[model samples]
Target: MRRGGGGGGRRLPKSSLAPSAASDRTPLLDPHVLHPRNLDLAFSRRDSDAASLCSSRPSSIGTGPSFAAPVTNFSDRASQAAALRVVNAYLAPAVSLRPPLPSAKDIVAAFRCPFKLTRSALKAPGTPHSWPPLLSVLYWLTLLVNSSESGAGGDDSPAASNDLMLYITNSYSLFISGDDDSVASLDEEYSSKARAHAQAAVEASQALEKEALDLESKRTKLTSGPSRLEALQAEKEALTADVEKFEAVVKSWTVKIQEKEESSVHLEKELEAKLMDQQRIAAENEELMKKVDAQVVNVRDVDRMQREIQSVERDNVKLENGNATLEEKGWELEAAVVGKLEEIEGLVEQCNQALRKLKPGIDFQYMLNTKASSPVELLGTSYKTIMKPALNSLADEARRISILKHDESVELEKQSQRNAKILSEKKNHISVCQTKTDEMVARLDSLDVEIGNHVSRCKADARLMKDELEKKDHHLSTVEKESEEFLKISEKKLEDAKRETDEEIQMCARELLKLIDSVTEYKEFMETSISGMRKDLYETVDDISSLASKAASTRQTSAQFVM
Candidate 1:
């Protein structure tokens, strides 16, 4: 496929390109542009994309900034035409007809135009063969050319001088002029801001005036009310008195409540301590019962061992007698079998020699007749003919031996199987025992956790009780102090009241005496009742401990039996 190209433009693959950045010391007025060789080449690329995109393609495309007043006018137009042509080609598939890029007339006309631009104060030719910096400037300028709006770019750029920023405009723009420092413009902005602030202040003053007038009117109404400062003060004083009276009553009530709570806490602590004691006793009883059960288990184990030993002794005696009798019989049988075996060996040798001589090629009877030896004659006789009978006997003996060996092997296998079965049973028993131990350990751990939690709770309760006791002590001290103060304050009044209310006081004294006598009697009765209750509780605790001990003993005994 053929691809379109833009005039005075170049194409570069990003991957094939290397960037050359300028050093900090390089001046802005450097006269370097894109690589010289890259500038002579037409904008063409292969191996990758070939689209007619309006992208920047820098290649030594620059002229002196001073020459921009003449060249930028027309050169930029030519560049624009080329760019437009490329853009048209890109959109040709969608829009069939398009005008050629800015015609020659437009390029010529643009050269005669004028544009406001910024110029750097630094002189060009600031460095020699500063290609590195020149390339860097071109890189920055290339970016500017590519991104500029309306394509307002050429070899010239906006001057760095402060005077350039202001009065800067495009061909038909009224941008801010450049003359003063940035601070001057900032000052102007601040001045306008100050004016706006003044206007805002004026408006705010008007609003504040209305608010002040409204506030003055509200003040007038507030002054007109009948509730004076002194009256408010008096009301506040009355409320304060009520608050003090309520506070005093609350204090007294709280004091009484605290005293009652203190006593209850002490009583609760006593009850908890008693319960703990009972539980501890029960636990100890259980432990003792477990020990007793262990003793029983040990006794049972001893009896089992003794019985096993008796059985083993009996088996040992039986095996010993059987071994001696079997040995004597085996010796006698061996002697008889040995002599018979020698005779059978001689006969076998004789038969083998005769069989070799009795080949089909040779007549055995003739060979025998020619030999005429003792062995040969014997071979041809009845004794030699008995070889078949002897061989049958040997076969039978071997069969008997094999049968006996097979029987013994079978018996040995059975015995091994039985022993293995017994061992498996023992292993199963051991595993069962281990499993029980693990379960017991789990139970013990659970019990320990429960006990730990209970202990922690008991400690917290004890601390709370101690706090209550301290609070009670503090209240008691406060009461004692207040009573002392009251006695001091009312000593004279008390004497005078005693004199004036003597007759009523005597009646009150008599009533108090009777009340005291009744209280003393009640105290004695409560003491006796409390003592009886303590004794009953002790008995109950003991009985419960005994029951727990019995239960523990039963459990232990049962466990031993299971083992």
Candidate 2:
């Protein structure tokens, strides 16, 4: 095969000849050229030379022109040949000497030369050796050569062409047999692709059909107009009712939350006030303790004052006793002085009687002693003056002592009265201080009790508030969870509805496109034939347009709802 020597006559065992691909790339044949045309060019070219079909150069055989251009050029040749065949069949009874021409089927088969060549070429494996292309070129040349030679005037040329045709056909069969497995595999693969494509198309068509039926049913129901409209209105009313009920529930919960917040604020204020009052009571208690301490000092001072007063009373009693003893001693001294004065008076009387008795006797002797008596009289006068001065001084001394004792007694009574008054005043002061201290203690105790109660109440209130706050937080979290779940459910429902709506929209669009294609073809066919039918067709077009517009609007609304 590599030496290019396997061109026409090579053969091999069935297994060794299994076909393989030349390359992974797709073949260059345009499968769109289904039929042939331009019979004149083909026939003229065929008659121009016999040598063009049997060129010995392998390059000339392997690489001719591309198949696309030639196939297009000969597009209508098959129809012409068929027409000629028909004409020939009708004229066969009248004229019988005409040479046979290739039939329409043969002409079409000739046009397919390029495709068959490409397919065979692609099926070869490894190196893109020249055999398949050359074989294809030979296949084409053989057909042209046979077609041209069949109509030749010489009988020997016809037999030669027949032998050539037989040789070419056998060679083509051998080449095909060499690569049979590859061709078969390719055919199987293509068949599978075609089957899959057809299945998909059928499924799509079925889906469109179902959608069309659904749309038709929906249209019919909607066209009933009043009944469907009434049903929609009823649904709207039910939805509005549900919305109102939910709104009411939301409002009530909001109100309850607001009330709870207010209560919490009030409780906070009360607790603050209670704390402040407790602080104040504690301050007052501390002040009372300070005052009680001061009062205790004052009471101690009062006690010292009372003790001093008691000592003063004791001194006053001693002074009073000393004054009484002085009075007794004074009385005794007065009595003794009186007794001594009486004794002095009796001695003076005896001396005076003796002097009288002696005066009678001494009258005789007085004449003699007259001069001596004058001296005695002078001594007596001196003695009497001295005695009077002394007596006066003693009486003045006694009066002074009595005046001092009376002044001392009066001073002692005044001091005793003053001491009693001072003691009573101090006792009254002590009693007042004690009462005040007791009052302060009671007030402090009351304050303590009140402060304790406030503290306890504040603690309890704080606990209650904390519990309520926890409850509120729990309730709020539950509400949030419920709301989230509700939102999720609504979103899921919207998504599902949106998905179904998108499917419906796609289905409608496909159905509409198909309808438009059919309608266009029909309109083109009937455009000039029926003006009256055209009016109805225009009306149908308008209806289709309106339906498309409605479908578009419904899709937009559904999208918005999904959003």
Candidate 3:
């Protein structure tokens, strides 16, 4: 409990009691006299008297010499006795004693005192040179005792208190010595350290608050996960149903398309058949046209036939006129012949009359018949007979020629009639052929018209079919677009959902990492604090043990001196 002693000492008093005004006048103890060599010499000279003097003194002392009192003369026996009693009282609770006590050298060694001390310095009749060393030792022992007691009390550890006190004392000393820079530097250092610690604590608190908010958000997300998942599942199911419906519609459309294709194929086959029929009809019409062309007579052939008939008629008329002229000439010639015959007859009558008159008819006949009657007689005899017979023969020949001319005329008339009839028949035949040809041409025109109409009808049907197919194509395209849009929407929704889930996962992973880092930092801080505390405890224990040993040795020394 006492606290007045050396500068390094903890709670040791410089003396047992307050100093009197007379004691204050004495000079303070010399630091050099407390040297180890002086202590050894003084203890050697009074070794015998120290034990008796220490026994005769009382254990309790009310007051003692002040720190300023000189110990060079070694004359203050009461101060010595008071110093011994204080050492005994301070050590009694710390050490156990036996009958034979140990020496002061042993006590000094056990205390691990920084100063050199000897047993002779603690004994009675101690030398003045040993006094300061003795007081120094007592002061060290008192500090040790107080430190030990404080450690045991558990109020505050002596080592920590002592370090704080030392720092405060150093700061005050620096300030008193006018070392303002050093003091300010130290203050700044401490202030900076405090600021650093406060900043670190603020940052840590902010980090904790941020972490707590993150955890809360994460918990909220976790809590809502099932509901969100359910919603997504429902949406997916709906999309699946829509897809199924779309697929069904597509299937139906495909079936309809197949039917349409089959119908179109059938219609194409029918159209082909109609086209083939039309081609056959066209070929037949062409053949008929060819036959008609072959049968049709040219106008030049009819004109030539008509001209030939006119030429034949003209030849017949000419032949008839020639016959008539021939007939007239024959008539004239016959008349003249008749006239000559009459004249001849008359003349013959006359001649007969004359012959009769001149010579007799028998005689004339006989003379003509007579042989050689001369050229003149023969000529005369045959003149009338020859002339008569020639006349008769000419008549007969003329009549026969007339009859032949008549027959020739009749034959020529019949031939002309036959030719006229043949010409008329040819004309009629040509007209019939023309009429038939006209009919065929008309029929060909009708067939051509019908074929054109059929072709137009077929073209109309094809146009209608094309329009229908285009309409169907437009409808199908619309349906396909709708399906594609639906699918795209579903895909987009799925992608968005996936993105959200990924973000959540990443956020959770980051939060977990942050928690792990905070835990690691806290663990390291605790480990460092614990290790420092353990080291401090070990140091305190060592100091206590050393002080305990010193107290024990001092107790042994007091007991020896008391004996």
Candidate 4:
């Protein structure tokens, strides 16, 4: 016989009851066997078995309807009561069979079952309709008992119990509907399933062993992790030190750069000032050139001086011609006076002769005229009247012409002296201007050389600064890359450590749960064994007391007979 609802079916040793006969007749009220006809047939057979078995024993069965009655016969009230009594007797070991035993509804409620079962349905007519739920309740009770007996702690979970119930129900249905051939097939199927289960168990054990080996290897690796972590920490400290040193160097370089910038700014300002000075000098030189241009003698002034000298010379020539003409006229007038004097002398001589003649005649004839004068008196009168006045006018005209020539000569001498003094001053000014121009040219050349040198130096400084900046940029980039790589490695190690710790915690929790379950089971077993022993000790005491009381009563009866 197989223990229904056990973890696995194990065949018990056959007794003298005959397996063939048991297999030929189905058991009564097997909850998994749902067919009505089969159930009735099985009940009839059970009734016959019970009758045969109880022929020599005292009858303690209830006065319900015979088991040979069909399920349809349970419709009447008396039959319903009888079926209820039968169900109660069958389930007496699992539930109380005393009066006021729990009703179907109370049982379902106690088990927290979704299936509805009422007291009325169990005790009223038409019990066939209530059989399925009742059978389900019986199946559930069977699973609970089997789980408790088997000591499999977690198998009583609702999902596992439900699955086992379905499988058993299906199998029992097939078993009831089939013949001997089907029975043999079911045996074969069970044997095959057993073999398959054994194979799966072996595979599971192998997988567990492999997992254990992997876990052991992982544990060994974890044990070595601290040393690597220490090394990484040391490397990180070294990197930090290097970073600090680099930062310090950068700070120093930045200070130097600031100083260089200040110097460069100063140089630029100096250059601007120099440029302004150069511009101012150039403007002053332009003004000087303009002054020189303004002071230079013009061609028109020289031409005008030459024209005045020509006019003065022409006036001198005219004065000389006028003096010659005056001289000639004076000569001609003296000649004419002489000739006229000759003619006048002739006429005067004639007149004198006539006078003389007349005077002579008069003198000769002193007696002829008393009013006759001398010849000397007549000549004196002629000279005083004409020659004296002509000579005096000519002398005054020559003196006036000499005075005009003397004045013109003095003015010409003064003009020539002034022109020479002016020419000397202009020559001195031109020399000074040429000397200043030479000095300015020399200064410009020096300034250009200085500017070129300064520009070259600035360019060299700029190139140096550029090279340094490029080197600094390269160093910074390399530092950043190294830091990033270190950070990534550190992060990976942290994640791995966290995952390992989480797995260890979960494994410990599972092991603790298993230990708790085993301890609970052992404690329960001890309690049950203790309770059984206590009951046996009580029963032994009761038996001994009863035997002592019997012995005492027998002694008293024997003594009474003796009297």
Worst 10 residues of 1 by lDDT: 66-75
Model 4 residue runs over 4 Å out of place are: 1-165, 178-211, 226-240, 255-263, 270-563
Candidate closest to the true structure, highest lDDT: 3
Per-model TM-score, in order, reads: 0.16, 0.17, 0.16, 0.17
CA lDDT scores, all candidates in order: 0.53, 0.54, 0.61, 0.56
The residue-level lDDT of candidate 2 at 244 comes to 100
RMSD of 4: 54.7
TM-score of structure candidate 3: 0.16
- Candidate 1 error regions (>4 Å): 1-205, 225-228, 238-242, 248-252, 255-259, 262-287, 290-294, 299-563
Give the candidate order by descending lDDT. 3, 4, 2, 1
Candidate 2 lands at a TM-score of: 0.17
* Candidates in descending TM-score order: 4, 2, 1, 3
lDDT by residue (tens digit), candidate 4, 1-563: 22322322322322542233434332333112122222222222121122332232222233332121112222224433444555566467865457877766677667654234445336642344445445544544544454344444333342232323334544676678776576667667767877898899999999999998999899799886778879899999999999999999999999999999999999999999999999999999999888867876886888899999999999999999999999999999988866854564566545545545433222211111213355554344544554456546756777999899989989988998898899889989988998998899899889778856765666666667667556655645554554465455545544443444345345434644564566577679989999999999999999999999999999999999999
Off-target runs (Cα >4 Å) in candidate 3 are 1-179, 224-236, 245-563
**Per-residue lDDT of 132-235 in model 2, one digit per residue for the tens?**
33333443444344334433422332122222333344456546779766556655665686689789999999999999899989989888767867989999
Q: Compared with the true structure, what per-residue lDDT tens digits does model 1 show for residues 38-87?
A: 22122222212222111222112242212121011111223334334434
